[model samples]
Target: MAIYSSAVFPPSQLWDYAVKLYNNPEVSAACLRLQDRRGLDVNMLLFSVWVAASGRGRLTDAEMIAGIEAGARWQADVVAPLRHVRRYLKGDIAPADNRLAAELGRGISDSELFAEHMELQFLNEILTRPATGSFGAAERGEAAADNLAAYLGHVTRDISRDDLSDLLQIWQQAFPGADPRLTGLFGPSLQ
Candidate 1:
């Protein structure tokens, strides 16, 4: 425990963003549903959001959390989800509907569902790509080439970008060949 604690770093905007990102009705619902059906924790749930968002491009934890909570891919997840969202976006995919979609939108198959996931896929792919800088601030560029690339390595390298998110990575890395989406919500505007 002490060794791990020594490794712990101060929380950044990224961590705060990650918290807010996951702390929402949709993500909460997704976590809840996953928990209800199979029991998940805050950390595991957060990891899921990370994968979904990272697929898009470089995302701060916040952007990823927001996208997941919204049930859209993380803005941090990348541009792919954004593109997906643009496709599924319509006149009424507002916040409440988005939330409802997240709640009621789980595991149902339909053309609408397929299209929505695809949009999110774009979001996921873009998120996993890589953010050039930090939150547009010059002070916090990633440390160096090796470190930066290692970080992006986690962001990329999934068959589906969502798999790049933390939990799936662990699941696949540890267990190999597991279902990333044993559960989650639907709709372009998930949160």
Candidate 2:
């Protein structure tokens, strides 16, 4: 989790643009094709961005290790799942209100879990960066696509605490009962 400035990322018209790229049949086909041939997790650039934005997005250090262990893990398999996760975390859509409720078998969707995670991860301070970075359309598109790929990287595993100090305070306040160990994991700034 990173305490990104709202000035760094706010919700915006980019949402539609992102979805448009996401829903493109040809893009989907190309993605799927890439997945089958190169095994999806191909791009290091996507992984780098995802690793930066989402804090290993996985749930645990072990999971992070596993991802690294999965030699040749491309960024493809991770994109869609990351997109799916972002949709819930960013509040663009309610997780419980969607199809996820039917999949997790909890009478609740993973989205609900994610919504809380977003709070614990980034929203606890009542802070949310506007999606307003100076990244150009191409950069934004690249970020979105890579993030989508990262979704897959995280879903099958747990989140890590790589750059988590940026969000630890929020997590401490939002989930006072959170594991002391968990908070410790993201305690100090990397620098």
Best candidate, TM-score: 1
Decoy 1 TM-score against native? 0.25
Error of 1 at 60 (Å): 18
lDDT of 2 by residue, 1-191 (tens): 22223333445332323234335454445444444544433222123233323322322334333443442332224334444555444453454654553333232234333332332222112222333445543343333333433444554343334213212332333233444242223323333
Residue ranges of candidate 1 with Cα displaced over 4 Å: 1-9, 51-191
Superposed by TM-score, candidate 1 places the C-alpha of residue 106 at a distance from the truth, in angstroms, of 32
Q: Write the per-residue lDDT of candidate 1 for residues 56-146, one digit (tens) a residue.
A: 2234555444444444332225433433454454336666576555433332223333433333433344344454433311112212111
Query: What overall lDDT goes with each candidate model?
Result: 0.36, 0.35
Error of 2 at 189 (Å): 39
Deviation from native of the Cα of residue 64 in model 2, angstroms: 11
